[model samples]
Target chain A: MAKTLTIAPVSRLEGHAKVTINLDDAGNVADTFVNIVELRGFEKFCQGRPVEEMPRIVTSICGVCPWSHHLASAKAADGVFGVTPTPTGRKLRELCNSVAYTEEHILHFFFLAGADFVLGPGADYKTRNVIGVAAAVPEIGKKVVHNRHLGARILNIVSGKSIHPVTAVPGGFSKPLTDHERDMALKMASEILEFAKFSIAWAKESVFPKYLDAVKTVGVIKTGYMGTVRPDGTMDLYDGKIRLMKPDGSFVDFDDTKYADYISEKVLPWSYLKFPYAKSWNEGFDMDLDHPKGVYRTNTLARLNVCDKLSTPMAQKEFEAFRQAFGRPCHLTLLYHWARLVELLYNAEYAVQLLKDPEITGRETRVAVKPRAGRGVGHVEAPRGTLIHDYETDDKGLVTNANLIVGTTHNNAPINMAVKQAAKLLIKGGKYDEALLNTVEMAIRAYDPCFSCATHNLDGRLAVRIDIHRPDGAVETMAN
Target chain B: MTERSPIGLAVTSVHRDPAEERPEPEDFLDKEVLVIGCGNVMIGDDGLGPAFIKHLEARGGAPAHVGLLDAGTGVRTVLFGMVLAEKRPKRIVIVDAVDMGRAPGEVFEIDLAEVPPLKADDFSMHQLPTSNLLRELRDQCGVEVRVVAVQVAWLPDELRGGLSDSVAASLERARELVERLY
Candidate 1:
């Protein structure tokens, strides 16, 4: 008989994940999977819709990181519409991207991951949360609140709302900015800049080295890194080419527009998350390819590796420092948080520049868009990794086909591999405890995935719900 | 004024990322005051109290208390942050947009402890929900946090300076309370 410990979906953190450790005949730890059991089928439900609705429709993915999906989805739709965003549209889009980064990254580090660091992994699940952080590290907790609070406020001003902004339309914003909003954005950007810088220095001084030392040796090392880069060879979020750094720390043909030829997603039997492989290696590949196989990593660390240089000098320095430590293409997964803070710094600096820019407050927000028929691929560097959205539409502008390479899907392969490694590291049949749970959570946290969206649809209308089906076309379960 | 008592109004969006990444202070060593405020500025008059709180935090007049927190319309997570801190603050004041149905611009303080109970599905950040916080305070640190709220006039999605003329006029008064409270 196998004893299974169940952990339910908790607020804060990325998404709902369940861990069930399986025991062998002798009741030892034979195998375990930190299962993302809840089937969030945004793809299946999104079929046969207008390509224009893709951005707002997919905003139903997750409450915390909706803006990420919105941007990715919008770009995909924009691509289908066959329009290159004007410079103003691009700037506003980046501005919105900055807000999402500030809010999502800060929320994760402070409210979600803060528990493990401040309260220790041994803290009770109910008490070991953001509330616990406030009681335990009140001084720092306040700072965390101030930082995220300001970010949220800034998003509301620029995009009209923080989470599921309706401003970033197909070609551009719904309403152009007023002078007051722009001025307010600049002032708040200053505080947010301070907030981000404080975040980076604090992590370096207190958190990074400690976490790096502890979990650096936990997972099986894999070095293939990937992310998005601007055509001009700078870090980018809104529009850029996807770059994958090979294990040798060498660049593999920096690409823009030609994305479909390079990336492919596969599924492993162990975990529900999809495994993405480079198009070259995906052929003739089955689930388990034996030992010493190439492992592709998405999320912050991979993005850090692919960029020519960070958009901001401070982040570039940190990137250099990170590279200097373990050599280029760092393989350790636990260092994802460190990469995120570095990006946060760059984002803040960029936000300062965007906020202070006079162009952002312009009255011209829309780029005249026409519904000409063409297949377009919109790729943006989601906080997680290279998020690619491809749409094929008919002459009427309705989406005939759609494909999404979500950020979490890229992390699936590494997560499955890391789980086995982490399970083996801990002696099986040892009392089920916080240390073991932390080991599992930390492994997936390395991926830093944004799973799905949850919205109430406001206006007294019910938002979309998640539906998971089986191979036989029957509903496995419904999360309403 | 239709001010809510920082108890029930909540904000939700599926497009946002869940709290995968939390924020640490840019300068943890320099942080001092934490103010927890909530309300949607775009939603008519709901922006009242939280808007005032934002004004003060932006201007940097918060006392040398500890930190100013904008819990937003998501008090559940805000409470989570408050309870997680290892170094408990000397004081905490929760500001929000409430609907007391009073004349607009009439500022008043209400106790979160005295507020009505929220249901299981209720996810509002208006008033600091106490059930979870109370347990953590007593069991973990042996101290219950404090909360403050102001009356709300309207909660339409478009509250610029003209929409809430009362809140816009009484904004300074609300700032004064925060200043005094700190």
Candidate 2:
């Protein structure tokens, strides 16, 4: 008789999720599903609200990546009003984006996924966490905390608030940077750049080599990729055309406003989150490991794969090394951590560049706008992945409709496929241990997914419980 | 004004010397008491925490030594920063809505020990690690921590603003409790 095994609320992720694996009568792995609870009320809540309020209101959607939502919403509002931000305004917004990326990348790489690499995946559960990482590598831990704090401080100076920022507006930035403030931000950003340099070097030296075997094998999938890039094919997190790349390295670029034409969302009965696939490929949605159709991934690895080159010199060098080792369109899921470090260095470098720009302190940051009936689509490369916000407004400036496709949602299908691949590869004849299970989780963690952003609905039910269904019609439950 | 203490807790103001240069992150912890309202304002009764903060503001806000913040869903960023900071507030009071099988609109205090250990290794703020981080702040960091909870009547399955009447009514009561923490 077949049996089922479940791992609920996969630990160390941003939000709640579970993995259910089925075994055949021979006790061999048959199938796997990653169930993520998604909130469905945000778009509905945006309806009837003034378009200007979206940037502020949308921040509450996910505390983990509010800056992403905030900036995307502001850009969407700018689209609704059909106004381009002043030069300085645009630079400031980009500065914030880079800073936010540095902060999130550090947190995810060092604290969240770091536990797995810093402490071996097989380490005892009790001693495998941020605290454990801190206890073991005291110096690195201190640097992590200090640098993370510095990112927040820079944001606080650039914008009035750091967490749920209100500084980015439809026309442009709400606050102007004083010379002194710019100096402070520049100094801190320079420091972050140094840390970014140190981070990738340390990982290359200490973390990646030790985990090379896992990196080459775990969660490996052959899917298309998507990300934002400049007209010249350079990675641009703040603004750019969307690039969709095939597994074979072929690609196409399109304006974000035309995203609906290229991407389509599929609803799955078991999971609340929607699976987004490359509709333009016309391959029809599928997640078969041997041949995935229209199933592409976003976030770090995908972004790195899609971008032709990195804008910053140091990051460009790292990108070249990564390509030389893994080749273009790298399918190694674990490389997401490596790709994330590259982006971290790029963003840190980008922040310093923006701050040093004389125009970053220009007085005219925003332009006046009148509420009008219009539709706007805005996209950004959030640390998790590509984030798109679509909004339509009436003449009265009230929101008539709203749609959002967060970065994590773009990887929904891929996440499921990766989880399935990992489960099938690691669990042989139903033999699995905590360490093995965690290694499987590392596959998912590599994406650094933020379920909090992917999920919009909340029912107040919180816990990680696993259920084992035996062939005898009996069930066993386990929780963490 | 008379100093107030809540059950075995002593409240005292620690003002920074005027001559000292105050950095930005430390400015947050400069107050003797920090009251943070944590919840999603767009999610039904979960909006109660921020609503309570608004209520306190409407009532002329807290004293100079107290800092009131509407953290919304971003409380983790603030709390996480605090846990790792060299300097921190003497006491932190978190106000949010909870469902503990109690009467709607009911206001109660949850001991630090009552915060469940939802995920032991989960450190992400988007998960249940907020409680874990809170515990860490209290146990390892030596910060006085307290929780003021309001039993939620209903949490909508869809995104809808405004709290249910019961939760909306409890805001004033919750405000009073938070004031007592200072």
True contacts kept of each: 0.02, 0.29
* Interface RMSD of every predicted model, in angstroms: 15.9, 12.8
Minimal lDDT window, size 10, model 2 chain A = A457-466
Q: How many Å off is the CA of A99 in candidate 2?
A: 0.5
TM-score of chain A of each: 0.87, 0.95
* lDDT of every model, 2 decimals: 0.61, 0.83
Candidate 1 C-alpha lDDT tens digits along B19-117: 223232232213444566654443556555456656776787565645655434344444444454445554555565555667876666666445434
Docking band of candidate 2:
incorrect
lDDT per residue (tens digit) for residues A1-480 in model 2: 777777766777887788878776667777777877444458868888878778988888778899999999999999998998889889989999999999899988988899899998898786687777888898988888888888988999888788789988888887777777887779989999999999999999999999899888899999999999999999999899999998899999999999999999987656667799999999999999999999999999898899889988999999999989998899999999999999999999999999989998787778776778999998899998999999998887788998999999999899989988988889887688988888888888988887876854434433233455577756665544
Q: Is the docking of candidate 1 incorrect, acceptable, medium or high quality?
A: incorrect
